[model samples]
Target chain A: MSADADTKSVTEVRPGATPAGPPVGARQDSFAARLRRDWPLLVMAMPMLVLVTAFWWVPALGNVIAFQDYNPFSGGILGSPIIGFTNFAQLFGDPQFIRAVVNTLGITAFQLVFYFPVPIALALLLNSVVSGRLRAFIQGVVYLPYFFSWVLVVAIFQQMFGGAGLIAQILRDHGHSGIDWMTNSDTFILLVTAETVWKDAGWGAIVFLAALSTIDQNLYEAAAVDGARRWRRMWHITLPGLRPVIVLLLILRLGDALNVGFEQFMLQRGAVGSKVSEVFDTFVYWSGLRTGDFGYGAAAGLFKGLVGLALILVANRVAHALGERGVYSRS
Target chain B: MSTTKVSGLAPWEEPGSLAGRIGKGGVLALIVLAVLLPLYTIVLTSLSSAGTVNRVGGLVLVPDGITFDAYRQIFSDSVVSRAVLVSTGVTVVGTAVSLGVSVLGAYALSRPGTLFHRPILFCVLLMFVFFPGLIPTYLMVASLGLKDTYWSLILPSAVSAFNVVVLRAFFMNIPRELLDSARIDGAGEFRILWRIVLPLSKAVTAVIGLLYAVGYWNAWFNAMLYIDDTRMWPLALVLRSYVVDSNPLPTATVGVNGFGHVAPPTLAIKMAIVAIAVLPALVIYPFVQRHFTKGVIIGAIKG
Candidate 1:
């Protein structure tokens, strides 16, 4: 479908713009001619290109400061003294930084196990609801939190599960000592995963639901006619049909492995303590921006970006190796 | 998939055993309640009067009485009211700027064979893989002297690559004949877009606009990093400080002794703040929800 979208009808505009030629040859129009013809289009595209370059590309290039003993107020990014591999060496040696990495990976892994299947289950559950009105109402209720900011989400959690929250208040009423479920450092991973599930599971199910709708219902009919039971039909037809989408989303998730999200961790850092709540992002925020250690922080940030890029590439490659269309196909 | 059953169950689908049906209904009820109950507490507690709040000693699980006093106090407070204005202003202006830039860019990219189209689109797609670093993004915004400015909240994060991609996809689906036929009528690309494309694409456009608006409304991290001045803060940042930080909101603390009026309890005041933060999403969701699901499906569109 998108392939059709990218085909150029503009080449058909110019009398000499040979539609018969290869796409490469057809666009061999002189720069000045092309400029005169396409300046409006370029003008339209300019703002986006300029802003993205300024905001995204420039800062990305500026990660070179990761290698420097950079002081922004003094030398700026340019004049900073170039130090070789020192920041990275220090980053590796820092126990806190190591912990942040481990914590980030741990959260990602835990969520993949415990939090990932929730949306799929939600989609199946919602799918089985006999009434469309009931299904839509439930979907409307559940997807509400996806729009909430992490602060709002954390606030809700605090009001529900914090030291003086509903859960604790009820526990106290039941003659049990109050439990501050939100601040339990021992199960920080589980706490985060639960919050993630609450915030995202319903919204995530939308994609699975979409996939389910697109599945051939006739397959189910055939399976039923062939004497496949409900569970057997679902296992054979429903899951297999959802497989491509499931794989694509899984690959995308792997690409985002390093990000356990920033704001959720940052907000909770003080409450849970840095030992438990600090992830790569909070580490950068505190060590780099907050403390003015730009070079050291830049190093951590660079490490994360590079590793994330590597992970996505590797994950995409693995997906391609499997017989699936993953995020982008080899073709 | 069949809808032939009297109970809305499909013919091929099993109704399940009695216990199974009960279990499913109960689970669905719990899931629905999990969302509704917390929301109910926050909203109800916000409405609970000072006397009711004091008696509950917590979130008023059930409202003894309803009052707008908490909201009245919140709006009366300079800090929160100004922050509300800031958040609204930012959401409006930021969503506009983002929509304008993204729509224009996506239109440009939608048509193939534009000069540098491939390169520009590649740059955008590259953003999905490589993000700007935290410190560097901060430094860039700071060095640009946007620190403490409202544009700091809007510009650095204005144009979403995903939105652009979605818009471009939707634009491409407008049958080529329509745009070409318009071209034959001497319509410029912008005119064609303004007249033909946008008119045909309202649902997706609104959906994208909604995404951008919600993003602007929910964003606090940028305000946190850039607008160090507390007075310039948006509602989301104010929410983080007053609600999440659990710092006593000025209104509840300042009470009759200072402001010469009874204030609702802090817990009620806090829930009111949360209610303020959340109300927009709740109000806006139902209106656009029909489009929202379609938008999500579109977002999952692959090249």
Candidate 2:
């Protein structure tokens, strides 16, 4: 489908040029010849390149500040003294840093167990439904929440589950003591996981649906001819068909385990007091930014980066062994 | 190999299987309900007036009355209106700037064997894997003297590694044959990219552009971290304070009051502010969502 689009674009734009070669000798003058021939294209692309490089690349170099003492007023990264392991040392010593690591790992584990299989299960359920219109409507409803910002999701949950929230009001009306679902430390893991599943499950289902479409319809007919049971067919056919895709997505998820949503944790940290809600990103923000400890934050950031990189490498290898199309390498 | 199992099945054979059908139906219904109930409450609460909301102690299954007053306050309120404008300006302009840069860089990177291509590409990949800490980023933005400037919000996030990768993939999919054909016709690389590449890549470009726009629109962390001037504040930050933080009213902390202390938050106005903050993405998503699921430009070409 996309190949056709690329072909069409090629045909439309570069007309009237050397349908055989750039008039030859255009090789030496390839730079100028190319520019003149493709001025319109160059014109379209130049500004965007310059802008991106200046803004993103220039500031990206700032990552170097992570290694420096980083006094903003005195000078920039080059001028600041490099502090080496001191930042890393301080970070390891901080109890909050340790807690953040535990919390991050804990959340990743919980999500792996509880939220990972949700979209797969939901996709199967959706695919099994007989009504097309109902399927589309449900898909639409489920996908809407994915577009909402973490802020809005947090607000919605608070409005519904907080002290003065809808659920509490209902419990009060029924003359039953309302549960403090929002503020309770024990409920944090469940609450966070539920929110993630609610927002992403449907969106995540799209990949599964794509994979499902490749299933052969004739296989179903053949099974039916043999009078195979529905449950048996599902277990044998549907589950096996989705195995490659499921493995691929699982690998990707594992690669991202070290990095959860930073905004989500930051938004709720004040309420939960960071004791339970603190994650690696938020800890970096608080200790590094708020407290002006540049080295510590960078060290923490480096730790996450290393872990994430290792996971991606291992996950990709696993996927390759399973004969799946992992993230980067196709073969 | 001799004990292989059959994997096909027909629905009618199980038509009378009550347990199978009922279990499937029950699971479907439960999922549908679980997803829809919270959304229903938000829509209902947003529509209901404060009086209706308080009277019910929260949203009812069915709203008694609908009001655009929340939306009205969002547009009419001074604080909200300014924030909304800032967000709009940033998203529109920022997306354009980002798309412009990303497309060019991606095109350059997509041309394999170019000078320094591998190193540059590796650098971009490294960017995705690891990031320098926030403090360093903050100091960079601060030392660069971008503090409190609107540019602070737009520039730091301007070059997204993900978008570049997607665009690069998209460009790579353009058959070498086509570029060769263009070169044979005496067209330059830039010409081929603009005339041939840009138009055909619309869907991916649209998706990437929208992704950039939405990211910029919903972004608050950048503004929170670098932008200190309230005049430069975007709507996401305002939404964070008003809607997410639950201030009784939409308030600006910039430009001190007579007492020179922080202002009190108003709840009713806060709800309206939330509505306004989300309005742009809501208005724009339906228009571009079709392009969004195009797989981040990862896949083999059909040719």
Candidate 3:
């Protein structure tokens, strides 16, 4: 069914094969006739156009706020004072902004290095479970946390690790003083990374599990028949089969590397202090909303967006060079 | 494909050495413990009496006494009850609107030779790379007078590009001949979509709807950004402020009518809030877990 659909769609794109082109008047008439025939499809697409225009394109155009003073009460976008490059200059000079960038990079680096392999490891562990029911139960348990809000995750972590938390209480019961794991600035990054893994590692493993299932079972049987041990078969067949997906996910992760998450940091920022917890997103929120520095905050946000765009483009290019399908293909 | 399905082990596939089995069991046990232990503590603590919670000085490992007082207090409080209603309303309305917009768009775009197909798809795909940035989006919402309104929560995120693309891929996978035969029978696009495409694509549609519903339910950041009125806050936002931010629950304002003036134990209250927030997802997740792998794999392959 899918193959037939693919071929039909492919044929729909074939260029006109006639010896002579239709006359200009005929072409115009045909365009109108085609529109008439496909008006329902156009109507179906209209809501999307309206929505994308109002929400996406309009807000995207509001990126111009990065270049303006942007007082909400001072008229609007048009009435806002134009200040070319001033916000950018201020953003670069601000030490807090610099700290946010440094923290974002630092946290993203930690996630890329330490957090990336966790799901693969998890998927492999689950795949080795011969009992299907046990595997399914484990997968369900692990994936449950992914649906939890950061607010709830943070609350759970705090209840476990806060100064007056379960762990602290346990320690104090043993005649030792309580430890302030949640509010300690030095370990904030580690804490957030642990929370992320706890929340998402299992969910992330679903894709890897899917990839693992697609590996030919015959390959494993053949390897076993030829005196290959279980571990050896996994090393030869499983890892190689998962390589493309790993690389694809890695490239996609790089594109989002700068966004090290907003809500998690925002929720926890007060407990850990801004010096250690200020990521790019929280920086924008604090500056724009709390301090009322909309222009500088917008400039910082715009900078992050542009960097993200460039990183995705570069990643896609590199993926194409490696002969792998990236996030999108160039038709 | 069925060759590997023998009930007993194949000749080449012996159960591993005893130590290997033990090691695997230990690791799996540890993983399961890591997930369940925290949850167990939270529930036990929530059920523990206020005296036990206070005496323990934190989360209760063992329930000294079981009581529904904490849950009772939370549901009785107008603030928490109102927040729950707000969250439910937002999730229902938002999911319906999002699915409506996404289904129409996906069906239209799934037709290969549809007018402006390439450009529309390109526009939607562009959303993956270029975010409009926080300050600008806030400015847009505020300027458009959606601030402090539920529309602010529902409109800006009405159509997810990822959902649209995933649904379109699923739609395109339906047999071309089925659609063609329907067309030959003089079925209009709306009729064919309603009578055929939608019915055939229930699994993906349900998966997408669940995703959107979960997203809407769990969403609090948008509320924090756009909502200035405390009365309009969702449960997640209320959870954040009351529990994570360590703010005292508004017991004084909740009035002293039903029970005594004494407030519930803060720890029990906090855990109960977490429980309230997570209960819905836990209820619905098992039914949807099987579909996630299939839906995600489809989206990944199409992408």
Error of 1 at A208 (Å): 0.5
Candidate 2: regions farther than 4 A off? A1-68, A74-76, A79-81, A321-323, B1-37, B114-116, B175-179, B248-268, B292-303
lDDT of candidates 1 onward, in order:
0.82, 0.69, 0.82
- Per-residue lDDT tens digits for candidate 2, residues B100-137, read 87888788766543333444555555565455556656
Tens digits of per-residue lDDT for model 2, A180-257: 556777889898888899778887887776566568766766887787767777877888988987887788788888
Greater-DockQ candidate between 1 and 2: 1
Candidate 1's displacement at residue A14, Å, is 17
Give lDDT: candidate 1, residue A289. Answer: 84
The DockQ of each candidate is 0.53, 0.27, 0.52
TM-score of chain A of 1: 0.91
Per-residue lDDT of B103 in model 2: 85
Lowest lDDT 10-residue stretch of candidate 3 chain B: B1-10
* Residue A166, candidate 1: C-alpha displacement in angstroms: 0.6
| Each candidate: chain B TM-score | 0.91, 0.83, 0.92
